[model samples]
Target: MGTNQVEMCPVARLIFVVYLLVTTCSASPPNFVLLFADDLGFGDLGCYGHPTSITPNLDRLAADGLRFTDFYCTSPVCSPSRASLLTGRYQTRSGVYPGVFYPGSRGGLPLNETTIAEVLKPLGYATAAMGKWHLGLGQNGMYLPTRQGFDHFLGVPYSHDMGPCQNLTCFPPDIKCFGHCDQDVVTIPLMYDDIIKQQPVDFLDLERAYSDFATDFITMSAKKKQPFFLYYPSHHTHYPQFAGPGAAGWSRRGPFGDSLLEFDSTVGNLLSTLENTGVLNNTLILFTADNGPELMRMSRGGNAGLLKCGKGTTYEGGMREPAIAYWPGIITPGVTHELASTLDILPTFAKLAGAKLPMVQLDGVDMTDILVNQGPSKREAMMFYPTDPSVRYGMFALRLGKYKAHFYTRGAGHSETTPDHDCHIISILTPHDPPLLFDLESDPSENYPLSLQGRPDLQALLQKIQAVREKFEATMEFGESQIDKGIDPNLEPCCTPQCTPKPSCCQCD
Candidate 1:
């Protein structure tokens, strides 16, 4: 009887192993919906502690998933941050440094760099990028999103403010425009795939258009039973704020708040679509910003809460962003102080989809454990790069554990009419000899500095940080700056049915 039972156990184990393999092979990979906001602040949503900016959808997302308190972007600006987010590497490595790409810029994100879309596409994921492809549009639309592994691309090449009408009166009349708002810059074009769908896009209609396009893609993907990766980088919360009719007068915080509410509604719409398609439980959604608020806009910009300074600076407010991760039946609902960044998105997603990573070295670490089992983050340190053109390579600041050391300090300049009169004072770059160290756990605002005069332990911490920086600098190879390339008018997109003039043919409905 004992010999018979032992033989039966081996057969049972073999059957069980086969069942496990079949179950794993039959289960579909989760769909990825990444919602990235442009110039959104840490305190913009109700879940992040904002009192007035009503974000019920985002608040509910936080309540159902993991909310990160110390999430950051690699850079404080648009193009560089987006580059790092997509490639999972520093902007310097990708050649998209110094500044953002203009419409006429001949260069763009280099072809060698592997994007998140490129990584996921080979694994049978239908990839689409909707809204704000500020990466670049090189000669003959070579560097556009469609050329870079995205199956479908619908959006503008750059910021809406970078157009012929910088200060469009279409925005709320109370908000003031800084800089040369009257300059006759090139008109912004809205693209569908590689073709120009509209020139001088109607800013008021953008939210609806983007939401519709996204829902359609999601529904189509669901019906086809194909896992999809939707990268929705919204143009809202940036300058030249324009809210749709429904959200125009909805906020007490003025146009910025109104535009934010409109963005919140867009998020709500996407959530509803996922549920309607019966893919809500199998989808993993990430909501975050490219960078911090544009405080130079004053009341027209976003609130960074208690953090210091704002966009274009290496301050906490400029780099730290509001990040929420929602995956029903997967991630536990809670807030984590563990440090993470946009860089982690690529490797994390790759791991989840069972896809192979790029061959080249990557700056981002896989954060799957942090999202799944609530384990400690693999990322222990973060480096902050400067947007200033002159100061290229190496980081302006380094955050190791709870301690953050700022090797250089500066603030974004504001216009003369800006109520914050001391902005100019903060704009001047100052180098710290010993590096200004602050305990971010205690002072997330970075208001007070720790003295390195007496404490040996603190001094040792600085030396350790310097060593890490030095090691990184010694091994890192900087890529040529694509953004610094000369601009060419011919590279700009122009719709068909040409107008009378040559360059002015860019105008279309």
Candidate 2:
């Protein structure tokens, strides 16, 4: 009998239908899960050479796929870095430069700019964003994740430390509160889409809540046989650190380490969900941080391994981050030191998902070859911009091949006694006439600057860097600075059952 003519039992028909669904999903476009950590250092994970930080899941992820030794975020601070990452362009191009967006800032990433989510959504991907979204919240929440192309959004509007927190005991005693720690300060809202679900979030439960939400999203997408893009920018290891119940005091590195452990566990949970849902092999997972460690936090902050300086500087420690790419059957397991940046994510994902590039000019190049076949990196040079608001549209450093030139050098102070000390305030902003050059391959810590007095080769290198810089700046069109916009109290979100006093009294279970 022909296959079509053969009569089958109900059980057999059900089994056949399930087989077809699985086969179709396997042949479909791959899913994407990007895990972005806040203020996590290059040396924070066990895979990245952290001696005390417990990160078994991340370690496993590295072992199973590609581990990048020299990956970077375009900017050294939160908002600018995130803006560049999503748009695949420089933060200055998107107008998210000068600094991060405050809670009441009306400005946001320009609506004209395209994001990775927007690129994938038209291709039938279900996109979700969990954890921090410091981009901005424009009038009536017009620039939130929902408007930014994410199908589901659940997280804080900005940094966790932006709001009031009466309790100091949750953090390690050694970690001083550099931000708001009083009850009188504006309360940070825990948002679900555009709605403020909870005010003054119980941070102790945040990690768990985020994990649960992400897992649910993954499972739901898998059941519907839909491709998904999960952008989980974790808030752990940021200031005012707090760990979930399971991870508190679980690591020897104190609260910072404990928070990382909780983040690692959450990673484990997501990976397990992918595997259980039978989509692990079909998913392209990437784990990276927004920027370098917050060294000002002292003992409470993360370690940058051998890299110099930390957040708020153009040094390697400030922009270089730990990055891992995992795709079970697609990406070969190995370590690569090829130059790459967060900017490459959007373009690379577009290439992989068969999505069209946005009309706007993009600073990022596709690194799909590197991810798939262990090919050489498409990027050759990278620019380092200042995070300080005082320095506007300035390229402080540039790295070409193995040589890095620092036209300007500044250090973000790391001192426990001086709480207010920052890069712009304490450190001298030194501009080099010839520009200080360093061989990053030999000196990742940037301790030694090469002398170019009598060396023709070094002189040529500097000239080449200058040429590159000139060409880069010649075509550069800086957008209006969104971060410079002053804050507005009226823009702050309030819960559904509005309270008498507004945000301060806005609370929900």
Clash counts for all predictions: 0, 0
User: Who wins the lDDT comparison?
Assistant: 2
For model 2, what is the alpha-carbon lDDT of residue 15? 57
Best by TM-score: 1
For model 2, how big is the CA root-mean-square deviation? 8.4
Error of 2 at 66 (Å): 0.9
lDDT of 2 by residue, 77-169 (tens): 899999999999999888897788877788999888899999999878999999999999879888899999899899998888776764433
**Cα lDDT of all candidates, in order?**
0.81, 0.82
Per-prediction TM-score to the true structure, in the order listed: 0.91, 0.90
